[model samples]
Target: MGLISEVLLLPLAPVRGSAWAIRQALREAERLYYDPAAVRTELARLEEQLEAGEITEEEFDQREDELLDRLEEALRRRGATGEGTAL
Candidate 1:
């Protein structure tokens, strides 16, 4: 941008910086959401909850399906990007 543009936009620098920080945080959150290891840990926790009588069989099945779906998605994403561990 030209010097005049930069000078005019200087007042919005903090807003720009805040937006960048929010984007970065969301990116990391999404990475973790699609992480295979994290999904596995969640699966284990769900099993424990079921065994401990904290959840019903129906609930367990539903949540298990969701977790497995996430695992599949994570695996697919990994395969597509050729990054991270595979299922």
Candidate 2:
């Protein structure tokens, strides 16, 4: 006697391309904003360093200006529309 068995199987679609495409999309997003939290935190720390005498006032001012400019530009590019005050 022969017995027949049947099983329900789900099809697996290709997700390799999806993963790459997602990564590419994320890279594009990051290129615009990159990381606002980290940038802001570092900028605050630079200010603190100046306050604590770790960095000279002139050095602190220069670095802070550079970081602020970059952050504002990135924010504007990300559609924050110059109102990127916080969060």
Candidate 3:
């Protein structure tokens, strides 16, 4: 039965493989996006941009808020998953 089912499903292998690859890529992207260190680095860069007058105070405030939200979320996720103790 197992052999028969596998043979029947063989034609869908490419679709399954593609779906799996897409899921893996999305997971990796999410991990990077939520990484605490990367978020901090981005926050620092945003501050520098403000100091350089590349961005207005309003823009800095908005971006800083977004980065803080990301950092908070990352810490929350880490706590939930017991992945690490540090943010």
Better of 1 and 2 by lDDT: 1
Q: After TM-score superposition, what is the CA distance of residue 6 in candidate 1 from its true location, in Å?
A: 0.7
Backbone clash pairs for candidate 1 read none
Q: Global CA lDDT of candidate 1, please?
A: 0.94
lDDT of 1 by residue, 1-87 (tens): 999999999999999999999999999998999999999999999999999999999999999999999999999888889786544
Q: Count the clashes in each prediction.
A: 0, 0, 0
By lDDT, highest first, what's the ranking?
1, 3, 2
Model 2 spans > 4 angstroms off: 1-33, 80-86
Better of 2 and 3 by lDDT: 3
In model 3, what is the error at residue 13, expressed in angstroms? 0.3
Cα RMSDs, all models = 1.4, 9.5, 1.2
Clashing pairs in 3: none
Q: Candidate order by TM-score, highest to lowest?
A: 3, 1, 2
Q: TM-score of every model? A: 0.89, 0.54, 0.94
Every candidate's lDDT: 0.94, 0.72, 0.94
- Could you give candidate 2's per-residue lDDT for residues 5-80 as a string of tens digits? 2122212224656778899999877774546676788898998898899999889989999889877776665576
